[model samples]
Target: MPTGVLYVMSTVVPGLVKIGKTTTGRFDDRMRILERNGYNNVTGLHREFAIEVERYDEKERMLDDIFSKARVPGSELFALDINLAIELLASFEGRQIYPKTSTESKSKVFDDAAKNHQENTDIQCIPEGTYYLDRKRPPLHVEMVVEDGALTIRAGQRVAEHDSDRADDRARELRRATVAADGTVRANVHFSAPSQAAAFIFHLSSSAPNLMALQKVVA
Candidate 1:
């Protein structure tokens, strides 16, 4: 008689979920690698520790099928066999962890200001390519090649998504590019309507130096 087990896990980070099954009880050894790598929030929320899994020759494949259906975008299994492969997949996706509270607090104001400024002007990192607007939407994504001194613009599904939608959807009247005085390849984006151009201009002027420091860390 073959025996097997099933488990459902939720990691320390949000948006991670997984389902897996194993034939043996030694899944912990496989899971330890995750803990070693700082995934301290991993928890097994549900499991069927032992079941007659060997009755079917396709048990491994069956587990894989279950995992494919139940596993979330950022999750994987931990046991050997089907479970190990699943866990490997989750590790590859990379879980998203929250920053510390103090770090969160520090960036909140900058995020707010960015949102406010983005509402009025679309300050974007325009790459070194000519682009035209399509009736569907404006291009919001760019591919940067610093070595080549080129920035290629392309259509994106969302632009300034962190900001609220405006009543008038039209081309932005004011856009400013923030390049470093050191001439490094870096850019910051801000956008506004014609009515808000003056405020956007003033904000960029006052914050350019600080923004440079902020960009340094992000870059």
Candidate 2:
């Protein structure tokens, strides 16, 4: 009796991992099937590793339990780093596929995410007009275009001004991200609370960016 081997997958959509079982040796085919099927949102998919095991369903259940906390609200995807995700999968049976990054890099990743969450600030600038943002950390701040009911933000060619951890560690989930975009992150919101939209796109505190009076050139 040939038992199916369970495979773990990773995608470029940050903080999302996939766990599934494949009976075929060419697991890429299965990935393709998934890409064309339900994973339409996943642009780039990477094969982490396929471990042969007994009772694939049991293995799937076990992985689910281990990552139950990181699992997305309504999907098979788990909100976790691909490397850390692989490590967790390997740890199941004492398997040793460690994370890609070294210990220092891993620590920095978490640390940065934590710093970003803790340093959230309230919006201080007055709203109601267009302006450019300037932050110290994520050097490249994008353009801001204000309109009647919605706000449009261009993407930053460089990283955010203030880089920090995004793991939501220590219950630090601050703002609501309306849209996750490449060149820009948009939020259909009211100007009265424009900071909400700004905080989300730049991944900073609402008050950090001069939402109202920063670079008046945008006015």
Candidate 3:
């Protein structure tokens, strides 16, 4: 019958996160303690997402069980993709406690930019060439080619599609991701911008990191 808050924190290490729970009143205090003292000797800890929920203890345990394989023994740390963690946390029925207004609005701006890119196909934000889109956690390396004002997935490894009930459709898209003679997976799907391309490849939202921002130009 315990009600509290569940939170996910990002660590200095990429793709690593800490999932924990605390009473509603102690939420801010807990964050300060973790950020100030650090956890397991790991510093640069920052809150990524949090939610106030009923029976938060049970919710936290459920998440731990779900990600047990990725968890560090005897520790709250898990070697999992931050975005995946965020999605799961957000799905829980509760009021979002972190990423207050300013951050949320920023995310909205990024989404709007993606939408505008889709609607205005003629506006090319990146130059035509080959580039690499690399993500650390749930590690991915995708070779992309931008030509004729279109972005195509030339090759990738460990590509994850958006999770949904449309298994058949997802399978069809995966089928398009063919394996090359060199053993790399290749896809012919075209997108307008890096964000859109990443969203499609990872089944992530518009908030996915834009390759342009990363400056990962290879060609």
Candidate 4:
């Protein structure tokens, strides 16, 4: 029955996180060593979340098993969502060690980060309008709009039809779209930066128009 700290570290690569455990007394020393020399030659390793708990070894093993599919072979790295990892780690019963906040919960960390991100990057910088895919015959359309003081993107496939068909097909498309509380169809995704949005849209459609262009097209 050893008391130790379970820590999650973020690597230079996005979506890659490391989970490990160290004795309470050696926690600070271990972190310093990892940060200074790097782990397995993986530099830029920084602690994201950590907690002191009883039987930290077992907790670490449990987390490894839970995220086994996402784990990198022969490494502690896991290609997992950072926020989800933080939320799951916070759910465990322990004293939050990293972040060194007045409150033990990590929700405040996320809230503050989001607030700072929104403040520093003006979402309104991008004009509110419809942007079509960068193709002769675009298959999808992305509409930018301001709702509740936040910029939102509503994207869906482009369907061509007559007026009667539009009434029926458009309604169906809206029904499938993610609806806000105000009955507005929102894509249900938020981008901290235009580059992030461009990456996401690129994943959806390789030929899709990027946010950098800021070209408003009527389709």
Scored by lDDT, the top model is: 3
Model 2 Cα lDDT, one tens digit per residue, 1-219: 445656667777865778777765656688677755546476566665555555667657655664566777666777654544333334233212212344333333333423343343212212334645455543556555555544545443322333336423211242224333343334433322334444554555443323221342321
Q: Which lDDT tens digits does candidate 1 get at residues 77-101?
A: 3322222222222211112111223
Q: Quote model 2's TM-score.
A: 0.38
Candidate that would win on TM-score? 3
Off by over 4 Å in 4: 103-219
List the RMSD of every prediction in angstroms: 17.9, 17.6, 13.2, 15.7
Ranking by TM-score: 3, 4, 2, 1
lDDT comparing candidate 1 with the true structure: 0.30
Q: Which candidate model has the greater lDDT, 1 or 2?
A: 2
What is the TM-score of candidate 4? Answer: 0.49
Q: After superposition, how far is residue 82 of candidate 3 from its true place, in Å?
A: 0.7
For model 4, what is the C-alpha lDDT against the true structure? 0.55
Model 3: per-residue Cα lDDT over 102-208, one tens digit each? 66733443445455445544314344556655666667666667678787775455455435342334333553455444435564667655555565555555443
Give the Cα-based TM-score of candidate 3 against the true structure: 0.50
Give me the runs in candidate 3 sitting further than 4 Å from their true place.
102-219
Query: On residues 33-148, what C-alpha lDDT tens digit does candidate 4 reach at each position?
Result: 98888877688889888878887777677667656667888988887665545544554557778888675445454334333434454444333444432323434344444334
Query: Which ten contiguous residues of candidate 2 have the minimum total lDDT?
Result: 167-176
TM-score per candidate: 0.23, 0.38, 0.50, 0.49
